[model samples]
Structures are given as C-alpha cells and as structure tokens.
Target: MESKALLNENSDLVLISGMCVAEVLTMQGVFTFSSMLPFFFEEWALDSIEAGWISGIYYGAYMISVMILVSLTDWLDAKKIYLAGALVTLFSCLGFATLVDGFWSAIIFRTLGGIGLAGTYMPGLKALSDRLSGKVRARATSFYTSSFGIGSALSFLIGGLIREWLPWQSAFWISASCALVAFIIVWKLLGNYPNTTGLRSGLRSLDFRPVLKNPKAMGWIACYTTHNYELFAFRSWIVAFLAFALTGSLGNLEIQPSTIVFIGVLLGMPSSVIGNELAMRYGRKLVVVSIMVLSAGFSVAVGSSVGLAAPLIIGLVLAYGCFVTGDSAAITT
Candidate 1:
C-alpha cells in the first residue's frame, strides 16, 4: 500500500527534507525585483505607481494561474506540475536577467515567474500532504510552509549582496541558477505519488458551489485574503521605504536596507512554525486572533517610527515581520 511504502521513518524524513529544500530553491527569484527596486527606478525612470505595477503583476499572474494549476492536481501528478513550475522559474529568471531593459519587459518576465510559483507553491504542499497521514502530515505541513520565509529571506540577502558587488543583472542570474538546482533536486529525487480521490470522472467540472456554501470556510478565506494583502504590500515596498529612510541621518548606518529586510524575513520562519505549534496546544481561533492583533499593532508602530534612529526603526520593522507571518501556518492548517 502507499502507507506501507511510507512506513519507514527515514524515508519519510528524506521526502520532507527534499521537498522543503526544493520549495526554498524554487523561490530564489520571488523577491529579486524588490531587492533591486532602487536601481530600476533610476534606470527605467519609473514612477512609484509604475514600479508597483511591475512588482504587483507577479501576484496578479499567480492568482490567475494558481486556480487553474492547483485544480488540475486532482487529475494530474503533482510531481509533474512541480517539475514544470521549476523549469518555468528557471527560464523566467533567465529572461529577466538577459532580456529585461524597461518596464514592459520586467512585467512580462515577472508575470511568467508568478505562473511558475502558482504551479509549485500550493501544489507542492498538496503533494507532501497526499503522501503523509495524521500527525506526521501536520508537522510536515508546518515545516514546508515555514520554508517559504527562508526562501524569501535568501532572495533578499543574496540578491542584495550580488547587486552590491556585481551588476544588477547578476542577481537574476543567481536566482536562475538556484531554480535550475531546484529543478534537478525534484526531478531526480522526488518519487511519484498518485491521487486516490474517486472523483476523477468530473475533470471538466470545477464546481465551487460546495466551497462557497460553507460559511466557516468562507470566513477563513476572508481572513486569509486580508492577511495576504497586508503582508504582500509590506514586502513589496519595505526596501524602497528603507532606502528613502537612509537619505536622513541614518545614511551612515553600516547595515544595508536589503540586509535588514533579510533579517526581518528570516525571523518570520521560526515565528510561523512556533505559532502553529502554539495554536495546536491552545486553540486555533484564539491564537490566530491574538497574532492578528499583534501584527496590526506592530504595523501601526512601524509606520509611526519614521525618521527615528536606525536601530529603533529596524527593530519595529523586524517585529512587524515576525507577527505578519506568525499565523500563516496556523491559518492554512
């Protein structure tokens, strides 16, 4: 049986670890645009709104593609979807690195990157869940989900360091290389797991009536939508805001804005994993509400902290990052 093949603890550990690493590597380009926003502003002569469109278009493409790609997982092998996504990411990063010269080109490549993420992110999560059962599945879910923060943090840190040392295009090249490695890891290592659901006959029908009728599910969806809006908006603009901050007395600070953003994002991985554990112990609703309130309070504090000492501003933003991702795993679980 499928569960029999998964009975070995060592094999299970290896599967979980491989998927986590692939997920992290696949996200190498996820925030490359945010890290290099300052250079683009100067080179492209882009206004704030135009730059936002370039950055925001990634999510727009993701939203459209995720629905189609993840839904197909019911009929297709998730491993296939993941492999395709990794290849798409690799090529999209290459395109951005080699071909992008202005706003329209950046938007085109960023959109492709988003479609690539749509194929991997949730579908990869689903693949992991399908192979494991009970408590092991729950713990693996938290680990896999938290790894996203690791990927995002690395994108900011590595992209920033590369941009500082080499040309701006080098950052995308590095991101492309990571995606290529991710493709190899999954293609060579991940074993296929077939879907067991009996509803395979209705492949053409993607009826949403059942989900829409569930008040509890819809309520959670509403909350998650709001959470994502705030979190992504902060991520898309924080580096630019910090760069602006440096024009003041804080200009002499040793830490780069991208490094600070990296620290803040890296801090979120532990916050997400630990928060899910706490929710399992106490109660999901109570834990989620408390985390949301804390996140909101920190957001306000960070906004009010402009022009303060570098350390103080950095502290507030880092705290905000922690709270922003704290409830992610819990909410999804």
Candidate 2:
C-alpha cells in the first residue's frame, strides 16, 4: 500500500527530477560554445582538430567517470551521487568563467563538467528506475530522457541570448547557477528510500568480459556507440557549420544559426518518441539501422553543400538532427 501510494505520488517527483536533470545538463552549453566555436578559431589560434579536442575531451572524461559513478549507484543512493555531481558541475562552470583563456584550460574545466554529467545522467535515470517499476517506469524513463533534449534546446536558446547580449563570461556564471539550482532540487526532494542506505564495501570492478561473451548485447552496444558518435559530432559542429555557411548570406535566412540549432534539437524530442513507436511497429533493429543510414547520407550532403542557400542547409541540418536523436530512447531501453 505504501509503495503504491508512493508510486501514485511519483508523477510530481519525476517532473521535478527531470527538470533538475535538465538544469544540470544545460550547464554544458555555457556561452553557446558550439555556436561560438568559429569565432574562437582565429582569436584563440586553434585549428579545427584542436578545437574539436576541446569538445571531445568532455565526453572522454565522461566515459571515464560514468563507469565508476554508475557503479557506485549500486551501493550509494543515486540522489547522493547526483548532488555531488551538481557541485562538480557548479565549480566547473565557475572555473570556465574565470580560468579559461586557451584550449588547455578549456579542456580541463570542460572535462570536469563532463564528470559532473557522468554523475547526474545515468544516476538520475537509476534513481528514477529505483523508484518506479513495471508500466510507469517506462514512461518515467522516456520523460526523463526526453527532458534532456528540451533542456539542451533551452540551453542553446539561453546561451545564445546571453552571449549575444552580454559578455561571454556571464553565460558561464548563469550556467554555474543553473547547476546549483539542480543540486537544490534533487537534494530537497529526495530522502533516503528503503534499501538505498546500504553502503557496499570496496570497489567493484567494471568487468566487460561477461557482456563481451554475449554477441547480441555487444552488437547493440556497438550500434549505440556508432549512433552517438555521429549524433554528438553533428551536434558539436552543426551550429558552427551553419554559421560558416551563412557567411555573406545572413540576410537570406529566416533564423540565426543558434536559433536553427535550437529548433533542430527541440524538434527531436517528439521525433524520438515517435521513432520508438515506429520501431515497435516495425522492428528496433530495422528502425535504428534505417535512421542511421538516412542521417549519415544526409550529413554527407550537408557537408558538401555548404555553399547552398541558407534555408536548404538549415533544412538538411534539422532533418539530420531529427534522425540522429530519433532512436535515443529505443537504443537505451
């Protein structure tokens, strides 16, 4: 009866939790960096690949920390880890605001922010999973993941506004404050749930041997990895690509580069839900493969046709963005 009551009450918790996750994730968009990358190229004396490294290092650090943080969820409560991660996010954003003048400094702080991401993302999902079971769990998970898309869109919008209107440092300061808000939300709402208090002793090794022995799971993992590589690469560079494409042609476009990126990302939220439904109707494997192929093909056209009309380039980007994120929930489940 108690559990049922809690489950009934959880709609609100899920809403708040999702929002908290969004706030934390939005911190990653400080200064609308992706949109600003082109500007930094000559100013910072950075080449393309070096600039890519500043972006890539975040995920690299995230990959390193996520295994440990998610592992700790088995022993420590997810909310506890989440709160700690929010702190890391807060400080990292602050660091970026004050410390970053060059590529190496940006890498250090962005990597720290990525660690904060490792803490909140999977662990927030874990926290949600631990609470809801059976039918409602699916909805909760979908809602939470979808919220990330919405949040990223909001970040682009907010960061663009701040960066355009004020000094770049102001955006990072606001982003750090967003992290603090995330911390407060999670900390205030979550108390220790039953069985969540047990502290498992010692470190548990992350053994991939068992999963590697299973070919089916390995295939899915491989597919998901490739899927993310393309998805993130497109996202990381899309705004800059659009801005570059608009050189001497800004008057021909309806939207600015950042706004286009925002719209592209925002539109993917429902597309993901719809794509999962389509996957169910057809098949997961079929839907995922088809989307990836289409996105890949479209992306090549986008790359080669940078000199095309701004609207055409933006349309291709929006289409690619939709397909890129469409299978997100399907792949996760």
TM agreement with the true structure for every prediction: 0.94, 0.89
Tens digits of lDDT, candidate 2, 55-112: 8887788878997898788777877888888899899989988999999999999889
Top lDDT: which candidate number?
Answer: 1
Expressed as tens digits, the lDDT of each residue in 169-223 for candidate 1 is: 9988988998888889888777787656546543642666776899998989888
Tally clashing residue pairs in candidate 1. 0
Candidate 1 TM-score versus the reference? 0.94
Give the Cα error of residue 100 in candidate 1, in Å: 0.4
Against the true structure, candidate 1 has what lDDT? 0.87
Q: Which ten residues in a row have the lowest lDDT in candidate 1?
A: 196-205
- The parts of candidate 1 lying over 4 Å away from their true place are 1-7, 198-205
C-alpha local distance difference test of each model = 0.87, 0.75
Clashing pairs in 2: none
Pairs of residues at least 3 apart in sequence or in different chains that clash in candidate 1: none
